[model samples]
Target: MSQEGWEASSMVSLAAWLEKHKEQLIATAVQQLSDREPLRQHAAGPVRWFFDSLITAIKDNQQERLETILRHWVSMCRIPIDGEPVGLLPVLGVFKRALWARLQANPPDENPLEFAVQLDTVIGQAAEFLSKVEAAALLDEMSHRLTAQAQTSAALANSTKDHFVSVAAHELKTPLTVIEGYSNMLKMELPEATNPRAALMVQGIESGISRLRGLIEDLIDVSLIEMSLLNLELQPVWLRRLLDIAAFEAGDTVKQRKLILDVKRDTFPAQPIIGDPERLLQAIQKILANAIKYTPDGGRIAVAAREINKFIDITITDSGIGIAPENLDRIFEKFSVVGDLGLHSSGKTKFKGGGAGLGLVIAKGIVEAHGGTIWAASPGYDEEQCPGSAFHMMLPLRDVKSGEGMAPAVATAIGSLANAVLERDSVEKSPQKATSEAPAESEQKETPLPVPVVPSKNDHNKDQTKKGGTEGGEKS
Candidate 1:
C-alpha cells in the first residue's frame, strides 16, 4: 500500500486497533506477572494501570493525558527482565510495531492518542538501556563498600590484639619486678655459710625473674607505642651518670657473654641534662642487652657518647651478627624482625622472641617519646669476618631551669629513686670506682645489716651454661 493510503487507513482504524491492543497488552502483562519472578509481579499492576489510562485518554480524545500515560507506560516497561516472559519475542515485536504504527498515523489535533504509541516505542528502548547502566553502577558501588568494610574489620582486629598484649604485659610486670627485687635482697642478706645452696638457689630464681620482668616491660612499652601514649617525664638527669647506671645494670650480661665493655667517659658531658632518667636507662639497657645476646663470646662491644652542639650522641657498636641492608629500616617496626639475618628459627627472619619481640620496639618507642632518635646500622652478615652492628641514640641537651624538680608521679619506687641518685653520684666521682668490686666481707660485717652481694656476670652465666648456651634465649 502507498504511504498516504496507509496513513489515512491507519488513522481510521487507530481507535479500534488501540482499543483491542490495550486489552491484549493487559492480558499479556497479567500473564507475565503470574510467573515466579517477584519483579514481574511488582511491575504487573503498574503496567495494567498504564494501559487503562491510555484507553481512557483515547476514548475522551485528551491528547495531553494520552501522551503522559504513554510516556509513563514506556518508562514502566523498561524494568529489566529477570526470567523469560510467558509470551515469545515475535508476538511481543508485532504488538510493539502495531502500537508504533497507530502513533505514526498523526491523528487530528483533537485526538488525544496522537503521539502516545510513538513515544512509548522510543522511550521504552531508552529506559531499558538506562536501567542496565544504572544496575551495573550500583553493583560496582556495592562491591567497593564491601571491600572497605572488610579492611576496616581487619584493622579493628589487629588493634584489639595489640591492646590485649599491652594490658596483659602491664598486669604481669609489677609482680615479676617485685619477685626479682626480693630475690636479690635475699641473696645479699644471707651468708654463704648459713646455707651455701641458699645464695645459689636465690641467684637462679632472681635470674629467671629478671628475664621475665624484662619481657613484660618490653610488651608494655610496645603497647604504649602502638597506642601513641608513650610520654616522657623530663627532669634534671646527669647524662654521664645514667650511662654508668645502665652499664652497671648490664655488666653481668656483658660479662656472661664475654663481650668487652669499652665505656668512654670523655665522650659524654658531666653536667646534668633535662630528660627522663629511668626511661632513658631502660632504652640503653635494651640496646646493650640485645648487642650482648647476639655477639659471640670475646666479641667487642663499645658504649660511647659524644656531645654535638646541642645534642648528645650515644652510640653502641658491637661485633655481633649484623643485619642485612634490606632489613635495617624495618627493625624498629613492631614485631618486625630483620629478614635474612638468620636470627629466627626455620632460617627465616621474623619477630619471634620470648616476650613478643618488644625489646627493640619499646626501645625505639621510648627514644622517640623522649624527643630523641635511635637507629641501628650494620655491615651485614659475614660468618668468616664476624660482622658488626651499631645502634646510635641522639638526645638534645637543654639547660636545667631552676625550681624544676622531679614530679612525684615520675619515680617508679622511692628506694630505687634514692639508689639511682646515689649511684649517679658514685659514677661522677670516679668512673673506675663506679665499675670496681664491692666492699670486702669484713667491711660488710661492720654494719649490723648484712650487705648483699649483687649477682655478677659470672653468676648469670652459670645458669646459662647449665642450660647449654646454644639454646635460644627465653622470652617471657
Candidate 2:
C-alpha cells in the first residue's frame, strides 16, 4: 500500500482518536495490567512513553519511528521486575483488549473494520519484536551461567586431587621409613664376607626400598607443586657446584650403562648466582637422569654451560632415542609418557624405562620458581637411527647483594607460621632469651658455605689403587 493512503486515512484517524481519548486509553490499560502481579509491579513511565511514541509515529506517518518505539518497549521488557520477566503476553493482551474495547464502543466514521484491522496489525508487529528479543536474552543468560559453573567444577576437582595426593604420600612415608630402617639393619648383620648370597638378597631389598623412597618423594613434590607451595632457599651458589653434585650422584649409573658423561667445566664462568642450591641440583639431576634413561648403552651424553647476557644456559644432550615433534611440549606435563605405555619398564637408567613421569614436571616447577625457563629440542624420534634430544635450561644470573634478587619469602616454609608466632610471643615474654639467641656483633657478618670439591674422572681408579696399596702393605 502507498504510505500516504495508509497514513492519511487509517493512521490519521487513529492518531486523532488516541489524542482525544488518551487518558481513557491509559486508564483502561492500567486497570487491565493491575490484574497481573508481574506487569502491575513495573513502573508506569515506560508504559506512558510507549503510547506517546506510538501516537507521534502515527501522526508523522513514519513506520521507522514506529519500529523504534516498539524496540524501546522491548528493551524495557528485558529488565526483571521481581527477579522474573514482566510477561510480554500479558502486557500485549492488556493493550489489545483496551484498544479493541474502545474501537467497538465507538466505531470510527470511515471504515471502522479497516481501522480495527490496522490496529491488530500494529499489535501483532509488537508481539513479534518482543518474542525475538526475549529469546536472545534468555540464551545469553544461560550461556553465562553454564560457563561459570564449568569453571567452578574444574577448580574443585583439581583441589580435591591435590589434597588426596598429599594425604596418601604422608601416610605412605611412615611405613616406608620403618621398612628402610629394618632393611639397613639386615644389611649390617648379614655381612657379604660370610653370607654372600644372602647379602646379595638383602642388597636387592635395599635397592627396592630406595626406589620406593624416591617415588614417594616425587609424589610429595608433585603435591607441593600443584598447591604452589614449593619453597626454595635462595642463596649465593656456584652453578658448577650444583652440576657437579648431580653428575656425581649419577656417576655409578653412567659407569654401569657404559655411557660417556662429558661435563665441560672450562666453559663455566667463575660468577655465582642467587638460587636454591638443593632445588637447582634436583632439577639438573632430573634432566640428567632423563637423558641417561633414553640413551642406549655406551651412548654419549654431554653437559655444557654458556653465558647469555644476564643468564646462564645449561644444555644437556643425549645421543640415544630422540623425541617426536608433537611430544616435546607434552613431555613436561604431569604423568606424561612419550613412548608406548605397554613397553614401559621400571628402571631409572634402563633404555626406554618408564617412570611416574613427574621428574620433568618437578624440574620445570623448580626452574620457573627461580625465574628460569627450560625446554627440549630433537630432530625426531628414531630408536634404530638414534637421533638425539637436547634440553636447555636458562637461569638468571643474580648476585646475592643485587636489588633484583629473589625475596626472602621464596625460602619461607609454609608449616612454620605457628612456630614463628610462638617464638615471637616467647621473645616478648623473655627479652634476655631473645638477646642470647641474637648473633654477637662480631658475628653479624654472614659467611657463605664452603663449596665441596668435585670428583675428577680418574678419582674412581685412584681410590682403587690406594686400596690395593694398603692391602699389599698388610700382606707384607
Candidate 3:
C-alpha cells in the first residue's frame, strides 16, 4: 500500500477505537470527578461535564457544539497541552481537510462520519498529554513549597535559641554576684563561732550560695558554648590532686544526702598531666553532682580513674535513673535531662530539684575542648533490676617528665591566689582591740566646731531689745 493509504487506514482504526471505548472513557471521567483524593478528583467534574456535552453533540451531529464543548473542557480542566490548549477547532479542521483530500483521491464524495471519528481521536490524544503535563507541574510546585517551609522552620528555631541565651545571661549575673558576696562574708565572719545553731545557719547559707553560684556558672557556660566563645586555660596538672580536691568539695553534699561516694584512685598517675585543670575539675564535678542529685539516698556513686596507654579514663557510675534506649543519644544535648524510663531509680524526677539541664552540656563541651571524649551509657530501664547510668570521660595523657617544668608554676599561682583571697577575707572580718598607740575611735567620730562671727549693729540691737523689754519691770 502507498504511505498515504497506510496513514489513512491508521487514522480510521484510531477513530473506530475511540467510538467503541467512548462509554468507558466517560465512566473514567465520572470516576475522576467523584473521587475524594484531590489530585485524582481534580479532573473528574470537568471531564464528566465535557464528555456529557460531547455525547449530546455526537447524537445531534452538531459540529459547532462539539467544538465548543471540547474547547471549554480543555480550559476548565486547566490541563497543560504543549504550553496551551490544543484548540479542538484547529484539530477538527485538520481532520476535515485530510478526510476531504482522501475522499477526493478515492470516492466521489467525502464521508462525514469518518472525518468526525478522526477528529475525536485527535482530541483524545491532546487531552491525555495535557493531563500529564498538569500533574507534573503541580508536583514540582508542591516540592518547592515544602523545601522552603523546612528552611524557614530551621531558621526560626536557631533564632529562638540565640534569644534565650542572651536573655538568660543577663538574668543570671546579678543573682550570682550577690550569692558570691554573701558566701564570702559568711566564710570570713563566722569561722570560729561556737554555737551549733550559728554553725548550722552559716553552713546552710554557704550551701545555698554555692548551689546558686553553680547554677549561674552553668548558665554562663551554656551561653559561652552557644556563642562558640568557650576558651580553655590549658596547663599541666596532677589528675589525682584535682580529683581529690573535687571529691573533698563534693563530699559535703554527698554526706548531707547520705549517699555513698567511692573514689577509686588506683588508675590515676602519681605525676601531673598537661590539660586545663579548672575545666577538668568542672567537668568531673558536673558528672559527680548529677550522680549525687539523681541517685537515691542509699544509692552508691563510684568515681574511678585509670591511665590507659596514652589517655586517662575517668568514669562516674551511679545506680540512679537510667535512660530509655531512644533517649540515650539525646541525653548530652543542651537543656536535655533524663526523662522517666518507667523505672523509678531515685523515686524522683531527674531534673525536677535544681537543674536547668546545662550540666551535661557544659561537661561535654569542657571534655571536648581539652581534646577528650565523653559519653553516657545505660543498661536500659528495668524496675526489677536497679537501673543505672554511667558517664565516661577520656583525656589524652602527656609525659609527666616533660610537663614537670610548667606544673609547679601553675600550681603555685593557683594556690597563692586561693590563699590570698582567704587571708584578705579573714583580715576584713576579724575584730581588733583598741590600743593607746592607735588613734582614738572618738577622735575619728568628732565633728568640726562652727566658727564664731561678730554680730552686726542691727543684729545686736535686735538681741538687746528683747532682753531690755523682759528686764524692764525688774531692773527699773
**Model 3 lDDT per residue over 176-249, tens place:** 67876886787677664555676677787777766666666677777777777887544445566666667877
Q: RMSD per prediction, one decimal?
A: 15.1, 12.5, 23.5
Which of the two, 2 or 3, has more TM-score? 2
lDDT of 2 by residue, 54-103 (tens): 88988887877766676566656443444455656567777788888988
lDDT, candidates in the order shown: 0.61, 0.74, 0.60
Residue 252 error, candidate 3, Å: 2.8
- Off by more than 4 A, model 2: 1-42, 45-77, 81-83, 86-112, 118-133, 192-200, 251-264, 293-302, 317-333, 336-340, 375-390, 401-476
How do these models rank on lDDT, best leading?
A: 2, 1, 3
Model 1, global lDDT: 0.61
What shift in Å separates residue 139 of candidate 2 from its native position after superposition? 4.0
Q: Residue 292's C-alpha lDDT in candidate 2?
A: 92
In candidate 3, stretches whose alpha carbon ends up further than 4 angstroms from where it belongs are 1-144, 147-151, 175-209, 307-309, 340-352, 400-476
TM-score of 1: 0.50
TM-score of each: 0.50, 0.66, 0.53
> Which sections of candidate 1 miss by over 4 Å?
1-150, 173-203, 228-231, 307-309, 339-355, 402-476
What is the number of residue pairs that collide in model 2? 0
